[model samples]
Target: MNKISESGVIGVDVHTIKSWIDQDDVVLVDVRETSEYDKEHIPGAMLLPMSKFDAEIFPKVLGKKVVLHCAVGKRSESAGKMLIDEGYLETVHMIGGIEAWKASGFATEVQITPPPSPSELKNQEPQFLCPTPGEVLRDEYMTPLSISNAELAGCIGVTEKDIEQLTQGESKVDVVLSLRLARYFSTAADFWVHLQIERDLEEARHEIGHTIREEISPRATASN
Candidate 1:
């Protein structure tokens, strides 16, 4: 409970939050629903939904700054007040919560549990699945190269969202990104492009099998 002038709850912008994350000086609390948090959230935020917020954790976070955030900012503001009223000296909440963070071009991570081990994977039945290009970027490049999304984006002359989206599977890899990835990894551009094609085809096949069938007409060709 670091003290910061008994002034209700201080509001911080996304920039300040980024700095805090880089400097390792802040404890980010996602006071949103677990489901919401699971979809996407700040890279290092801890989920403590407003529904079951634990005042007892305040003591543990004492000495370090604590910041709370919800989908927008209202819930976090309320949660901040609760902390303040409960004697947690200083508290801050993101001015616009997760939405603002994303709008500001910051990186977000989907909260998926790690995949099973090779042994476990072998035990499971085989399925027609394609890995996201982002998964490849993360495991094959980012982790091996020890590079952050910001660093890669800066070097490759693209917005962080471009890299983040590709890695998170939210966006497909276009010609431009494929070239960039290939150039950065010293691989052929086709390698990256093919990854996207494979995933799209697999997903399309899966959806077709699960959904109702629709009739299709053959395309007419030009006559010589």
Candidate 2:
């Protein structure tokens, strides 16, 4: 199949594009003015203003499959056509724009925040960061069901000393502890397992914070 084609384009509704936001492989570009974007746009969309389509924006997106959108369908259609002509592998325009998106029961919000930087993209991670230090302590020490440290330690066949040491950052996480904890708590087995495998909870906590602030916050915005 010809990778680059204008006539064979597919137009997706806003709701469909919204559902694809969490897919790591998809890239959604909004071909609207900065002002329009600030007022309201899809969460996680990267803006490549229609007025500024040039070598700078064109080259980076050349070989990738792109989904282009605007406030209505007009600008996105224009942008997609231009991108196909510029040798983009595939360019699909959003059919109904933001209004059609909202009409389908997908959420919308005015994005007061600026777009993420390239450096930000390079450092992105995942959720499980927003919990308080006390919560982290609880996750480590307290029983998952009862929220009592003593109870949890007993169920896991570990002394309170073990739980205390883990919570106090004194003991390095171990696979044995992780397995026992997973069975006892029935929470995120991989997270506990990862603590042992990676041998670094501080680093993991720090990374989780970045994800919470960047990627997770956008979803919160959409819901509001």
Candidate 3:
């Protein structure tokens, strides 16, 4: 009874076609001008231009559904009708064609999108400027207490260069320095060490935060 169906040519939407590409065994046949295809086309599509379209020799993958499409629906419908006329079991063509596919925000083989400029890239790439421990030292303790680099170095039992680099954000505060700073400031050692950890995390985030988010996801969130 299904073989006696009303129409052999089935019209499919771009979203459905896209799902077929992603989830099913399907072959996309593009019937368009060479110039048009050279500009932009669906990835992995077989080009069989309508200018020289021959339905008799139309490719049919053994276990795959052949989906025909053109720039607009007209030529593809005509092409599909040709296949039906050629004693084909069934024919499928994308309704609204590549025009609908582009309208639906699907990526094509050729990209006409302009690249961002240097200034635009700079604006797009985020800068995370969390307070470095050097900034904390200079702003919170050193400036308020009027502790000179030499004075702090002598008191903390560190070289003047070490204190200078630490205050200038070029060096990191480790356990020894954190303990010394904590004892001198009468604060918990965790305070300085935590600041260093926070600074390290901020730096790491600035460098590869986006890549990490793209590559790794929580298992629950990934399933969703």
What's the lDDT for all of these models? Answer: 0.72, 0.58, 0.74
Ranking by TM-score: 3, 1, 2
Candidate rank order under lDDT: 3, 1, 2
User: What local lDDT score does residue 45 receive in model 1, on the 0 to 100 scale?
Assistant: 89
Query: Tens digit of lDDT per residue, candidate 1, span 1-224?
Result: 12222237788888988888899998898877666777787888898866666555654565667888876665576567667767875678887677788888998997667899999987866343245677667754577558999999998889998888888878888888888876775544555676677667767776684453455555789899
User: Considering lDDT, which of the candidate structures 1 and 3 is the better prediction for this target?
Assistant: 3
lDDT of 1: 0.72
Candidate No. with top lDDT: 3
* Candidate 3 weakest lDDT stretch, 10 residues: 1-10
- Give Cα distance to truth, residue 125, candidate 2, Å: 43
lDDT of 2 by residue, 67-138 (tens): 887765555665565555567635677776665777787766674667679999777663221222223445
Off by over 4 Å in 3: 1-8, 111-224
Positional deviation of residue 211's Cα in model 3 after best superposition, in angstroms: 42
lDDT of the structure predicted as candidate 3: 0.74
**TM-score of structure candidate 3:** 0.46
Between candidates 1 and 2, name the one with more favorable lDDT.
1
Task: For residues 1-224, write the lDDT of model 3, one tens digit per residue.
Answer: 01111235677888888988997679999877576687789999989876667767876679888988876554566567677878775788887678789899997888476888998997896433234667667755677568999999999899889989998889998888988987786544554676677668877888899899999987765453
